[model samples]
Target: MNITIKGKVPPKAIIGVVILVIALALFLLKEPEKDDLIEISESDSIIDEKLEEGDLETTPVIQETIVVELAGEVNNPSVYILTKGSRVYEAIELAGGLTEEADTRNTNLAAILQDEMKIYIPSKEEVKAMEEQSGTKAGSDYIGGNTTANSSNQNKNSKVNLNTANSIQLQQLRGVGPSTAEKIIEYRNKHGRFNKIEDIMNVSGIGEKTFENLKNFITVE
Candidate 1:
């Protein structure tokens, strides 16, 4: 349908109308983009949090150290710091190595070090004195008391009298500590004097292995 108008529109009014249309279009397009950006930001934040949690789980923990006293014939005898699983030799080394007179033959250098343990290193002269008193040679199978005999008579007189020996005497045998020595005395007291050396095995904690180590050194007669 054709219609006739007799008025002219102002240039400023037309320009304002055009500007309003452009602004409305821009707002509609930007709204969806803003919503998309917000969603992406939230997802990135979640991923970053998950990564941080993973890093924490994979982090390594450090082990704690132990303190021990290293004494005896070492050059420097004092309390030293060490890690777990350290051996006696390491402790000795930390103490500035052994002295010239230190006798290492009796020391178990390969033994594991314990906290507050005292590693006493005896002198060579002291070991010799002990050997002379024990009657058997130093570092021999015989443990505890003094013995004196020639090589031909060594084994004959070196045996410990199990029936008559007290707890202190019993502790002189290799592998016989205070607890094991006490057990032996207790067993002997309860069951009467051991009739045979094998009867020592009847004591609690004195197993076959202990008996094996002690058989040569002990006697009932």
Candidate 2:
């Protein structure tokens, strides 16, 4: 003999199965990735901050030009706004005037000016032509350029007393020679300090014209 059995689910079991199916479907259709949501939130916050601020303060950039003051031995010493290629002489012109003792003869007045160059004035004796004339006229057989020979010879003949000369002391003066420079030194040693510049004339070969020329560049003190 054979026996058969039939089974039917309860109403609660069917309801629970339906609820689980709904939950699984919701999870499968979820919104977006967590990283994407976080990125969207940060972007929205940044945009909100920008919109909240009405205006932003911006710093201004300024370009500046420099000006310098020049005085001392110059025709017109004063404050000058120099361009890129100004020279020493140009600055000197800004100042009122140069002292009579200013030694400009050695200066390359035509030379370009640096950032802070001091253009000094020259004295009468520092660039005297007499020494040049004496050297040229003393001997006409000189083969060098007529004008150049005279100046060259004069420069060669002129000697400086290193021990006693000032800034202008090394300049060429009339009748100055190696012997004269030595004599000037000897005098300074024997007689002590020179109270006056005129004492240079006391040395042999330093005539009145030489002394006059030297007066501009020389100082005893």
Candidate 3:
């Protein structure tokens, strides 16, 4: 008995079927790689955004301060830091306040403080010694920025301190009467402080000639 074929198959049809199978296999294999690339690109985009946000910096804030030193006749004398425009009495209070031997009459507690200022709280005996040595009455006034551990804080070489002087202290000046003293105080109050001794000329009626005469006998300190 001889073998018999069921049907005739075309070479082109077989070739076409082979090509379709190869194409289907390639498409299936490439799908995972395409999904992986998409996920990696999305991950890279997120990482780049985080890096850009991390590159930006935040600004810092700064605050002004005043450093002063309080010594002599205070309970606890040391350097202290305070806000700008802090007064002398506030510094003294930070230093634990004045002791019993402290001569309050010679210290200007109400004066506004300046940076790097050194305050010396003089004793009563020290004030007397200063008065005896200077051959004059020297008390009830002391301007900012002084240093001398164990001496009077109000001498200013027996000259009046124009900055911290009260009405009575100002009257002790050669030509300053009560009205001028009030004007000086008013000027200081209106402004802030006498940065220099010549700033007194800015006051009403205290002219250049008056300043020349008062120069050697007064100071802003």
TM-score of each: 0.42, 0.25, 0.49
Question: TM-score winner among the candidates?
Answer: 3
Q: What shift in Å separates residue 138 of candidate 3 from its native position after superposition?
A: 6.1
Work out candidate 2's RMSD over C-alphas: 16.4
Ranking by lDDT: 3, 1, 2
Per-candidate clashes come to 6, 13, 0
lDDT of 3 by residue, 1-221 (tens): 99998888989999999999999999998776778889999999998998888966779877789888787889998889998888889988999888999986645577677777667777888666655644233443343434433244545457666666655557667788878987886676447568899889999999999999899988776
Q: Best-fitting candidate, measured by lDDT?
A: 3
Per-residue alpha-carbon lDDT of candidate 1 for residues 92-191, written as tens digits (9 for 90 to 100): 8999999999877755577565554455666676566655555342232111122222252345346767654534446668888778866775565345
lDDT of 3 at 18: 100
Rank the candidate models, highest TM-score first: 3, 1, 2
lDDT of 2 by residue, 1-221 (tens): 78655687789999999999999989978968899999999999988887788456678876443354554445565566776455555656656556675655444445454343333343444345433443232211010011111233444444433333422233334545556654664454344456677877776667788887777656543
Go through the candidates in order and give the C-alpha RMSD of each one to the true structure. 12.5, 16.4, 8.4
lDDT of each: 0.66, 0.51, 0.73
Model 1: lDDT of residue 210: 85
Distance from true location, Cα of 143 in model 3, Å: 3.8
Task: Give the Cα-based TM-score of candidate 1 against the true structure.
Answer: 0.42
